[model samples]
Target: MFDPFKDFDQAGYLRNLYGEKDPQIVRGLEHTLFRTGLDEALAHVAKRRTLGYSDFLAVHRILFSAFYPSAGQDRAATVPNIAVSKGNTVFAHPLDARRAVEEGLRIGQDKAALRQHPGEVMGWFAYGHPFLDGNGRTMLIIHSELCHRAGFCIEWQRTRKTEYLAALNAEIASPGQGLLDGYLLSFVGAACERQLWGGAIDGIRGLDGRSIEDAVDGEYTDVRVMQKYQAFEMSRAMSKADRR
Candidate 1:
């Protein structure tokens, strides 16, 4: 049971408004609640002319505040002393999570850059792993919007989960590399209208793909944890330097 917050009141799941304690049941309720909230979330994103870190937070808040009380709060502010990881991949430190996400936003805001380097922009967001929950869905919405603004969108429906995940994981592990970029380029197509995006988002297989459940938490002060994060920072720095 993954409990990154260490506040799971029941069955490794965070406390929810429905008062569900069973992980299985919570999963069902979560899916329903999130779907119920998608229209609002998408509408909110559609109205936004510009995307930023705060807008990213707002997406999570819209989709999850009805369920998780900590909906919009990010790791950097809410869990600053914890380090989060999935399998062998350690994300940015809690304190650095916001900055990492901001880096992605800065790059994505450039329409030209976003069109050319969507994977690198998304890699920073994934590595940042900002929110305790709903990071995947929130980022997807933000990413789709950015792509639309850039005059193209990924044909996510045609992409295989396993392959896409592998590429995404690689991108996060080594930013500035074209691993994900190459994988995603083939799927790029003319942008769909905003009104039709709801169907596209709904067609997505897992709303919270690879949900936070797979994330393991550790003390930020742990020697091994600190070492892992340091390595990631060093690699990120090198990637940036190379780009410059």
Candidate 2:
């Protein structure tokens, strides 16, 4: 479990005290549970008046709090330099994260502008890299809401990971070019209600400078103690929630 690359932040993902390093076991244990939390976040966000930067943090927190202790916290305090897993793209520094996200929200908070230039807003969120983990999923949930509010939804299942990721890399490099927009435009379909989120989030779409498909189709090795550990984690999260 001491694998540096997968456990870059050293979050200690193993179910054993001996540190059994298996990313698949870790992912399998969390995948189904994360989807559950994502649904909860979607429902919570929908009840709000308008979306903003805070919701970005809230979504990440809700989804990953069951796994990571530092789920929703921003990286500004430590200011870690982030490297893209997909490419050599450089993300924005931690100091600039808050301002960058705020400006993006200010511009795209209007549903019309967000739909017209979703890539711009996306670029801003991607660059911020607010959470240490779950960056992609957090943005996807919030962005989906914005798109639906603007009268359309991205047909994410139709788009190929490689194609969309390449465009995303280009957008990250350029920030505001139409590369990602053009790619997504073709897959633009009617709005999808988040209420019917049965399998909407059960895809390999939580990509952010990382391999999505590989993460989803993990070789689930036997981790018999994983369930016990997960129960402990859920209790921990519930305790934290109660204190709050």
Candidate 3:
């Protein structure tokens, strides 16, 4: 079992409402509910005049409230003492998760910046790694909305999962390098109507975000974990300087 939260006994497998232990079974149900939740979330966001950090959490709530008791709660609030990572990427410390997400939104909301630095914005969101689950789907919906407002959209249909994931991972490891932006630029196209986006998103593969199963967990206070996060910060700082 990939227990990223390290509270499988208490949280019941990422705090799922059903208390499901089987990954495969949980995923099956996730897909079904995610579809329904996506529609609701899209509607909720559509009504917003401007997206903000709170909207991000609201999206998570709308997407998984039925399935997860901690749906809208950020890692800072729910798992502040636990460190989480996926593969080689260490996410922002729980205390900094909110800042990471806010940074992404700050850039993504600017149409010009988003067009030129979509990857940077995406990297921040991925780095934020807010909720224990549903981070992927929540961000995608918000991203699509940002794209729509900006007059362009990523043709996710053409982007392969492996290639996209590689770019995402690369962006996380080396922020502001344009690795993801360059890859995503090729797939950029005219934005579709918002009403049509629901179906388009639903058709895309790997919407689950995969952080739930692939994440490696450690206590935030662990020396190794602290080092990994500190290293991530140092690397990010160097990358920021390089961009300047």
Candidate 4:
């Protein structure tokens, strides 16, 4: 069996990926060394480096800054507040981080008991908005990780935006019926296919006004790329699920 978590040397991977001379990479290395104790963070950085996927806008910045805050700051500062949205509905109430963490752990550990469906999990977290920042990216990472661990591969690359959005909307509107689970399973199936096919399938497109095709064309292509990407995603998902 392939160990997804094996040999994750975070510092080395970060330095290599961002290039040893890049200031941002240097700062990220410094921050990780100083702040987080989580053994997986560096591994995630390495995995992402292998995949060539840039961090989602805010999430990337937060990750970098956490390791390298302004001059006098002790650690990356906590985000001020988080706002969650479900289509037209939005909530600004304070999220109970501890409660969210506990629930996340429960969801991950008791996958069989919950017979967990993706939409409920997605809705629960999206609505919960546990982190002050990185909610969307974090949710995606966490959800993907659980499905992968459970023997499914969620291919965000192949997921139709309309379907993905619909599942999210359904969860926000109804919160039950398992709509998200079905959609996520389909996505997993697609991802697995893409992995087997070796880049014949187009990866995620339409993020940040760039299509997946364009993103791939603009960067390096290697078989290990998507594998690494999947690993990073799995890490995020597992981490979140364990928190609950």
Candidate 5:
């Protein structure tokens, strides 16, 4: 049993980050769609879906395009063309880039049995920084998707910018998942309970990984909008955190 008001509060917090015209509406839609996407992604995970480098790139592209439409960047088209660099520099070489994605997927699967730790996954994605722009946003969505697949939720309550960035930076420097593990366990636990008790409880339960049809029902009428706002807010918040 989760507390719905808390979920709404989280949505509100994210909406503030997005600076939406109608924060409530924006938060509502973004939260909804994000949940739907999470369900779909989790289903893929449950089916043992092994995502290739290209697949990971595609997911990031879709997530960024949807969340930040004004970016005018083609992440998917650029992923294959972009090479990973070595020696701790961001986007250093192609081989490193490919290895990063591969490692991310492997780590994601390996940690599937444990509590969903989005910070670890996100740290991997951020360290990989697969794309030039929207990396943070992409990581959040990808991590959320992975969590949903693992039968858990990402609780992002009272998450400040400094803390999030520090966690990410620590991972980048050490290549360990402990920092992220702490964040996800704390954040997601709160978020799950919030969703369960919120009006979206039914919507959350009805979320099917195979499709969005279940999420589109009247019960989730406001969910799509909520998800959009939530993504926007989460991205903005994460980026702000990274800068601090």
Candidate 6:
């Protein structure tokens, strides 16, 4: 029972071709990957991205291709069971991941779905704990797109990580309550237009890696688990008109 959170460098930094040990070198390379990849990720957002589950995977892959081989793929696809936490907060069970994401996408399609029930929707996606790394950063883009489609956006720069994460943890721990919604709603500001996308989203903050994992079992993915996600689309029935 080796705990990865307590274990350092569980997934070795990909670009460490020479087995470099300097923390500065590792941090620099990781930031470089994020800065360069963000340019492409912003471009995808410019075209009115109504993300399906595959698009969700694509966003992670697109942003972290330079860093990890498991970038875009969900943990369920590779690892069987994972334990993810942030400092002292732990995410939901791996077994419910597929159904949780399917539910999140379904609710996020509407114009004000996020505004109305931000807690539930945000909790579901966070609970799904889809990516082994870069979940927060990738989801920020996806959440922003949903906000943009809904005719608004979060003032991410204005959000303090302390407050946002506390709220997120509360929501994930208690699914029905509106802890996250209340905290996030006050920070809702004007959407960043096309010219501003790059400046707004291009940074190291997105690469913070909020999600962490512990134990990994190989027997978690069975027929029942796979079936829950078989018909999972980006949304329930969202149209181009609805997004606008």
lDDT of 2 by residue, 62-162 (tens): 88776666667786643243222223444554566777777678766787777777776777777676765567778778878778777888878777877
Candidate 5 per-residue lDDT, tens place, 129-224, comes to 555443554455455555655667665434655576667666554455367667656666522432332234323331222211101111113665
Ranking by lDDT: 3, 1, 2, 6, 5, 4
Q: For each predicted model, how many residue pairs clash, with residues at least 3 apart or on different chains?
A: 0, 1, 0, 19, 35, 1
lDDT of 4 by residue, 58-120 (tens): 333444344323211111123223222333433222334334334544564455633456566
Which structure is stronger by TM-score: 3 or 5? Answer: 3
lDDT of 3 at 111: 97
Poorly placed runs, candidate 1 (over 4 Å): 9-12, 208-212, 239-244
Candidate 1, 121-182: lDDT as tens digits: 88889988988767777888888888888899988878887787789888887788887889
Worst lDDT run of 10 residues, candidate 2, spans 213-222
Best by TM-score: 3
- Candidate 6 is scored at a TM of 0.73
Comparison by TM-score, 3 against 4, better one:
3
Off by over 4 Å in 6: 1-27, 45-49, 203-244
Give candidate 6's whole-model lDDT: 0.62
Alpha-carbon lDDT, every model: 0.80, 0.63, 0.84, 0.41, 0.46, 0.62
RMSD of each: 2.1, 13.6, 1.6, 16.3, 15.4, 7.8
* Cα lDDT for residue 193, candidate 2: 76
Better of 4 and 5 by lDDT: 5
TM-score of every candidate: 0.91, 0.73, 0.95, 0.46, 0.48, 0.73
Count of clashes in candidate 1: 0
